[model samples]
Target: MSKHKKAAPQQRQEMSGVERLGLRVSSMINHPIAQTQRWVVIHRLDTDGEAEWEEVIGLLAETPELDLTFNDDGAVTVRWERSALQERDDFIIDEDNEVETEVAAPF
Candidate 1:
């Protein structure tokens, strides 16, 4: 007789927007090694078509925990674990700050 095991139910944990984005950034930076100059862009559909590339770069620059490398071809790559986490947090924080500012501003 063949033995079979039942799969366990998946558990979903509640995470803040910052935490969610942090997870995403972590996953991206942890991707398998590839060519040094291939740039990976993360795009958001909201904010009137604004791209998050510069924000990512800035986060990398500001945080020391993240080891960000730029290739001669102008492609940026993140290769460290802690750095990835820091960058992710920075992105989320910056985004939240921007939203708060926009909400408080008089149009």
Candidate 2:
């Protein structure tokens, strides 16, 4: 049998403006739903030299069932159904407080 080894982890690529923004927003909540409708927590760096958390809700193109609420304080909360099959598998999306702080901070 031929021997095979696992490949090393690749370095993260530099994010574009939109990606940066998305990444920032994704790191400030807990248990974000993935593309498969599974909940996952997103982690990222913050301005205060700390880690932050966030959540993301995956949405299907054919089925549209997501809503967003934005507060005056720059905070956002999103509510959406987890799966089309479930009667009530909704989730809330919150702002990545850490990322927001990071973006606002003077680099």
* Candidate 2 per-residue lDDT over residues 2-98, each given as its tens digit: 5898899999998554456455544432333232332222323343121122223222222355454554753444444444324434433332322
Q: Cα lDDT for residue 30, model 1?
A: 40
Name the regions of candidate 1 deviating beyond 4 angstroms: 1-24, 30-51, 81-107
Model 1 TM-score, 2 decimals: 0.33
Residue pairs in candidate 1 whose N, alpha carbon or C atoms collide under 3 angstroms: 65-83, 66-83
Candidate-wise lDDT, in order: 0.44, 0.37
Number of backbone collisions per candidate: 2, 7
Highest-scoring model, TM-score: 1
Stretches of model 2 off by over 4 angstroms after superposition: 1-13, 26-63, 85-107
